[model samples]
Each structure stands twice: as C-alpha cells, then as structure tokens.
Target: MAKLVERRPLKAWERLNILAFLKGMRTTLRWLLKRPITLEYPEARPYIPDNYRGTPTLVKDIYGREKCVACQLCEHICPAKAIRITPGPAPEGFSHIGRAPAIFQIDRSRCIHCGLCEEVCPEEAIVLQKEYSFSGTDRNAMMIDKEELYEAGGTLPDKYFKWGKSE
Candidate 1:
C-alpha cells in the first residue's frame, strides 16, 4: 500500500517567483562584471606548445633531399590507415638510400593525429608539425601528396647523413 504524503502550499512571494528572479539577476551581474576569457580566433591563434601533435608531414634533409627511404613503416603503423606509399628506385644522385617513395599520400580526414607514424619512422622523415588549423572544401582538397608534405615540412637539419659517408 502507498502512503499518502501531505503537501505544503507555496507562499504568495514564492508563487510570484521574485526570489528566483533576483537569484538569476545576481548570477548574470556576477558574470557581467568578470573579464571574458574568450579569445578572438583567426586574428588571435592560441599558443601551440612544442610537443603539440598536429599535422603529419614528410620532412627533407639539410641537403633538401627527401629523407624517407620508402620503408612504408608509417603506413603500416597508422591506426587510421591514413598513409599510403609506393616505393621506387631512388633518384639519380640519391642512390645511397636505395629506394624512395614514388607516391606518398596522407588523407587528413582519416588521420587521428596520434603521432604513431612520426614515432615509427626509422629515419625521422615523418614529423608531426604544429599546424593544427587546416580546412578543405572537399575530400580531395584534404589529401596531401608527397610534394605538399615536403613543402609543409620544409627542411630539418640532419646531424649526420646516415646514407652518406660520415665527415
């Protein structure tokens, strides 16, 4: 059996909700007096830390040559399967590396920015840059090819040329 509960009637002031309105106004006034923490985007990009994992890009050696030997380690390790590589014989003077990627592509839409590709690369050819803001009109626009990756990565100084004779 359910027990019957007695209900108390609201007072005149409570029915009018005057206290509730004043409480809401107090909250609004408190917030209005505080300085805003919002940042104006586009005009003011937030600071990106040194260890920020953003875009994945293929870097070049100090000599402006592609550092990737086309081992396909990045492709194999990518959890999202965003990387694709096709190996070919190394270009003319780059015979020291034996092979290079004839075709390399990264689909930004599929990439999770996990930095696994960067970590798995034996040559450190793949790097996760501090470029978090990127947009594309369509899927094809988001697909970054080998040349675009090289351009975005620019050049990272190599302490030693593993493929060349040590000075």
Candidate 2:
C-alpha cells in the first residue's frame, strides 16, 4: 500500500517568488563588489613545484654525451606503450657501454605522463621535465624523437661517469 501525503496551499508572498529573486540578487551584488582572481595567461605562468611531472625527455651527461644505454627499461615499464626504441651497438668511442638506441621515439598523444618511464630508467637518462605546454598541429609533429628529446632536456651534471678516465 502507498502512503498518502498532505498537500499544503502556498501563501501569497511565496507565490510571488520575490524573496527568492531578492536572495539571488543579493548574492550577485555581494560578489560584484569583490575583485576578480583571474590570471593573465601567456604573460604569467603558474608556479610549478619541484616534484611536478610534465613530460618525458631524454637527457645527456655533463660531458655532452648521451646517457641512455638502450636498456629498454623505460619502454618495457611504460603503461601507455608510447615509447619505442631500436637498440644498436654502441659507437666505437663508447666502449664501456654495450648498446645504444639507434632510434628512440615517444608518441606524445599516447603518453600519460605518469613518470613511470623516468622512475624505471637505470641511467636516469629519461626524466620528466617541467615543460607542459607542448602542442602540435599534426600527429607526426607531436612525436618526440631522440634528437628532439635531447635538445629539450639539454644536459644534466653527473657525479659518476662509466667512461670517465681513471684517476
């Protein structure tokens, strides 16, 4: 069985709805007197924290040599399957390292920017940089190749070098 509910008649003031309108206007007027907190973009970028993860890029050592040894750890650990690497024999001068990436590419559209690639890299070559405003008109333009990654990452000072001369 359904329960019956009593219906009540509206008062004259409630039917006019003037109180609701006045309440809404009061809220609008209160906010209109305050200053806006809008940020002027392009000229002013928001503050990014030290631990902020933006995009993955390849870095070189302080000596201007590539730090990645083509370990493929970053590619294997990537959840988005955005990273691709083709391993090749290390250059003649880089005898200490066994292999290097003949070709390395990352599809920006597929990347989730989870920082897993950075965390899995043994040589710390791949890192999440503070560059978040990457845009491209086409799919090909969005793919980050090895050269481009290195150019964006620049070089990072390292305390240990596998190919460093003995003291």
Candidate 2 C-alpha lDDT tens digits along 1-167? 99998988899999999999999999989989998666788688888996789888898877677789999999999999999999988877886679999999999988998999988888888888898888899999889899999998888665433335331
Candidate 1 residue spans exceeding 4 A from truth: 4-9, 157-167
List TM-scores for all candidates, in order. 0.80, 0.74
Q: Write the per-residue lDDT of candidate 1 for residues 1-167, one digit (tens) a residue.
A: 99999999999999999999999999999999999767899798888998899999988887788889999999999999999999998989985688999999999999999999988888888999999888999999999999999999988765434445331
lDDT, model 2, position 82: 95
lDDT against the true structure, each candidate: 0.89, 0.86
Best by lDDT: 1
